[model samples]
Target: MMRGVMNRKVPKEILDLFEKYMDNKVRHLNRKDAIHMLRAEFGLDEEQASTMFDTFDKDKNGQMSIWEFQQFYVCMGTQPSNPHSSAQEVVQKFKDIDADGSGKIDVNEAKEGLKTLKTATGRDLDPKEIEFFIETTADDDGQIDLGAFTNLLYRLKLYNAPPPPKDVKLKNPKKD
Candidate 1:
């Protein structure tokens, strides 16, 4: 995913229509409706739709307005800032990984945690990559807190980085 600009535009009329769809004067879509809209109208799968919601809902509110979604383009681009942006999931993962409840994970725990993640997500992360990440990011004491762990998967490109800008070429959109 490109950590860059999003220049695509959504018309004001569509925003208005969305507001009307919700039968609320305020320009908003609650979590369920927002996710549904992304899945139905944009044809995003459930995971993609939820990720978009997590990326777009900057305030971490259960609702979003079109403008809010647009503003987040500056932060998230078309791809999310973090794949596991859901608070509950992150917390659960932290608890599962932090074996001693020390609020930190040592290198060994991190390795085990990555294995657990691979089992859960079906994404096989390279062991060498984990070593590299630990070598670089772990504290002098050789431990990382929740914040660092949250960034790990994303900073690692979830083990698959986006193509370089020069190699990227936009394909024409298909018409229905």
Candidate 2:
């Protein structure tokens, strides 16, 4: 949710990529061109690439500028410049948390899911906050469908945070 920090620094590599593929002198990448670049350069499938383009298009105007890309990396967290994931991966995460094969997550299930997320991400979310998230996303009957859950995760960047760097304590250790 951190947006519009004027002094934030964007990595040169990111800027280079944008500069390389810029379609116009204005240096802005429209949605179609960005999608093509993402698919070609990053090997992302169309859906995955489109998702990333949508994320960076902050103004929701089908165009992405260098500044928007910088803000996206900021929102995605430092160190891991790009945390985009395929829709399949996101669907898997939703299925993992849904439990009981119900295709929907109830309030109680959301609590358990929140605990699992905390364990996985080391993020501490209060039970009430988790409940509120579920309540707000759920239907009048109080059950969140898979689509809603996926959208929530996408917006929150829950499934997009890269794993912590692993410290290789013993370089070239014997293979098992």
Candidate 3:
């Protein structure tokens, strides 16, 4: 059993799609930088990005080599240009978060799922903190449904940081 980092293979088609999307949306960036940029821009923490990257980087080389990236590039590139337009995408995301594909995200699932999100957004959420969140937010059913997941994402977007330009400067103005 491969424990630490799962060796899930990202299909070549998907890899190719990811690369194509990157080329069009982030022409100046290398794959690693692009990944980081996308995560930061989207307000995802390092852990989330790492989990996503790990899924695509079957070989676990730390970087998405051209070959590996190409596989994802193809899949993501062909996806509907309006990522939010597809209900299926939301459903799939919900399913992924469920982990067991159980159609319900329990406390553990929610904790783990939020941890992944924190990672993607470069945020640090301690396990105890996550447990607290789950206790407060989860319903009596002990499950977070797809609707809840969407709401959570929407809330998360509210906290997204503004992007900084390449050359950011701060200057003090003369007091009048």
Which number leads on lDDT? 2
The alpha-carbon lDDT assigned to residue 5 of candidate 3 equals 22
lDDT of each: 0.57, 0.60, 0.52
Better of 1 and 3 by lDDT: 1
Q: Considering TM-score, where higher is better, how would the candidates rank from best to worst?
A: 2, 1, 3
lDDT per residue, candidate 2, 1-176, as tens digits?
12223225546666666666785555578888888876765555776567667756778889888788665444433243443444345546666877887867777777787666542355655555465456656777778665466445644555334333344222212223
Give the TM-score of each candidate.
Answer: 0.42, 0.51, 0.38
Give candidate 3's TM-score.
Answer: 0.38
* Model 3 agreement with the true structure over 147-175: per-residue lDDT tens digits: 45654554453434433343653222321
Candidate 3 stretches with Cα past 4 Å from truth are 1-86, 119-122, 160-176
RMSD of each: 13.4, 13.3, 17.9
Q: Which parts of model 2 are misplaced by more than 4 Å?
A: 1-9, 41-43, 77-112, 119-124, 132-176
Clashes of 2: 0
